[model samples]
Target: MPRFAANLSMMFTEVPFMERFAAAAQAGFQAVEFLFPYDYPPATIREQLDKYGLTLALFNTSPGEVNAGEWGRSVLPGREQEAREDIDLALEYALALGCEQVHVMAGVVPQDADPEACRATFISNLRYAAERFAPHGKRVLVEALSPGVKPGYLFASQYQALAIVDEVDRANVFLQLDTFHAQKVDGNLSHLIREYAGRYVHVQVASLPDRNEPDDGEINYPWLFQLFDAVGYRGWIGCEYHPRTTTAAGLGWLAAWR
Candidate 1:
């Protein structure tokens, strides 16, 4: 069976962030992931992980100026310095928390931005991040955000993300496939799983259209879980979804997997 990680960012919103660690452990999750951990000290987050005996699966670098509509600086030209700073900060947190993977966000493209320039900037920034994290035994991840949810984002297709990984050409850099985004952009998910089985380093899941629990989605998650096992995908599958009702109430989908 595939190991599932509770995404604290989208799951368990009934309690505060810190308390969600215990909630996840109580719910029988062995690992957890979140969007960003810059709001709290790394040591504090580590304490909760140790207390609950949970492994920190993954997290992303800070999205620069979220309110200003900036998802990241890596894909924005002339922001190489800021991107490096973001990478360094994320490395600090990953080492402190004992995490093995970090997602490097590709910022949204400006209305007047050149697509080629943005792609080049993204490749360069990813190469830099990979080099930096390689020495510490860490991996760098790049994800494709759906254009509908994040309009003008760098890329929305898994092919685009895979191409970026190829261009970066670094062993440490890999794709982070989110099923929700993949289903939104490209619907043949089964083909994607089989075709890119060993290419991606992490996987995230949620229902299509509603972005709810995986149990009722158009995607057959139970079969996908079996496929993941067959393909030798030994990585954490993040539960990055909003519940139909309460988080705890909607977790019946996880019981069979547990």
Candidate 2:
């Protein structure tokens, strides 16, 4: 089985954010990831990681005005400066916390906005980020979220994300393959992995139809893990699902994996 990383933003919510690191470590997770880390100081987060002997696997750029429904601002037409600032901020935290990868959030677009403009902005922003992160030996990642879950998300399919990856033209840029989104929008997971095996730098997991634990979902995770092994995917698998019960009680699936 592949190594698993717990998503503190989605899992282990039964405890405080600082407490989640210990919770995940105790539960046998070797690493942890989350959506955003801006709320806490980097040094504090580092202390927890060191204390628990846990690796900081991944985290995202700031989600602009999350309460207002802005998932990310990288693709927004006029927020170029703000987007770059977010990228810089993420890098600082990553450098301090020893994180190797950062996810760039492409915010929702208005229905009337020009698609070409959005694509151009996204490409430009990605190129800028890739250059900035390259010197630090860090990588940037983008994901194709399912429209059913996050409407107006820039890329909703592997093809769209891959196209952007090409446009960015940076070797350090790669796709973040989320199994839940793939099942929702693009169902052929095996073919996707075979076609784009080396393109994905990070992988996230959740159940289809509902973003819940993989154990109770219809997804054949065992087969998927086997497929990943066959494809030579040696990256960390992030558990980005919501627990049906208390986070501890809902970890039966992980117990066996550990």
Candidate 1, superposed: residue stretches over 4 Å from native: none
What TM-score would candidate 1 get against the native? 0.99
Per-residue CA lDDT of model 1 for 115-223, tens digit only, reads: 8999999899999999999999999999999988899999999999999999999999988999999999988888899899889989999998899999985888999
TM-score of each: 0.99, 0.97
Q: lDDT values of the candidates? A: 0.94, 0.91
Candidate with maximal lDDT: 1
Question: What's the lDDT for residue 2 in model 1?
Answer: 93
Off by over 4 Å in 2: none
Can you write out model 2's per-residue Cα lDDT over 1-258, one digit (the tens) per residue? 788999999998988999999999998899999999999999999999999999999999998987887898898888899999999999999999999999998878868899889889988999999999999999999899988889888889988888899889999999999989988888899898889999998999988767888875678887888899899999999999998888788788776666
Q: How many clashes show up per model? A: 0, 1
